[model samples]
Target: MPVDLVPTPGAGPRVTFTGLGGAELIIGLTGQSRQMSRWALGFILIAAAGTALARRGCGSKVIFIVVVLTVASLLALWLPATTDVANGAFMAGAALVPLYILIALVQRLWNSLFVRNM
Candidate 1:
């Protein structure tokens, strides 16, 4: 199931699930929800940092090792949270590492192909 973070009028962020009965789940309203929300936010920030580092000429080997470790950690957390319908969190967390790498690669290719002084 894919989860979307949608904003509402005069309301906080809302999580909506697609292909899982079309339900809207609101998080961060309570203790556990708030913790989970913080975790998710932290994960996104880490992923973004990793992506930025990779883009700034970090070697592929280093990025791969870091991404692998990140995915592993996410899996460890996801396994316990799986029973609570947090698949979207897991998916987004896992996907961001590779997505950033791909973005860096595309940017590099674009620079090489069109921006080279040659």
Candidate 2:
């Protein structure tokens, strides 16, 4: 490699660091590696499971809704970081998982509260 091609300490071109979601020291690029947050992983798993469950007996509309929401949430949480772009709005996707969970809880509560009386 040419001497000029070497990345100097603190004098190299600006490099955007993106989170690798648990991958560390990949291909000699330490800057790209990041520890995956447990919260993020949990949310991903929940969304995946929810999607799977939604497909079993739910209508097409319901399945579509679930898939879209889950995809959008994942994209929002990960796309910006993957692309090396700084967009705070993308982080909002992290909330969607909990939001969906909350919605389910509310629905269950409603059903339990009223359906049992019938």
Candidate 3:
């Protein structure tokens, strides 16, 4: 790491600080799915259990459920949308770059949450 590699305050390269949904970037990470399958099953189990619990009474576990569902969705949307064969408007690829980043963040968060498995 060299000082020259760093940019000055105002001279820094511009970055669009998208809020949560800012840039939608999707990344397909391989090899972890097999390891995480149990967690995935656990999530499904939780979903089914949570639905039953919700019928009984809403609970804090909903947050965890929502987060899990969100990860599953973004992961599903990420890889195919960003693939080279993905067809869309001319800017699809350019726009997908940010979308892909959002996916990466979700993946990172998921990985961190399961650090032992990760």
Pick the TM-score winner: 1
Best by the lDDT measure: 1
Per-residue CA lDDT of model 1 for 3-117, tens digit only, reads 7756678896666556947655555334788667656765565555555555454466366546645665666587654323343334454666677678778988999988968
Candidate 3, 1-118: lDDT as tens digits: 2223355677866765758665655455546565355445544454455444433322344454455455545544785533222222212323333544565578789878876662
Give the better candidate number (2 or 3) by lDDT.
Answer: 2
Candidate 2: tens digits of C-alpha lDDT, residues 42-99: 4465456555554244354355445645665666567634322212122333444465
Each model's RMSD to truth, in Å? 12.5, 13.0, 20.8
Clashes of each: 0, 0, 10
Compute the lDDT of residue 86 as modeled in candidate 1. 40
Higher lDDT: candidate 1 or 3? 1
lDDT of each: 0.59, 0.49, 0.46
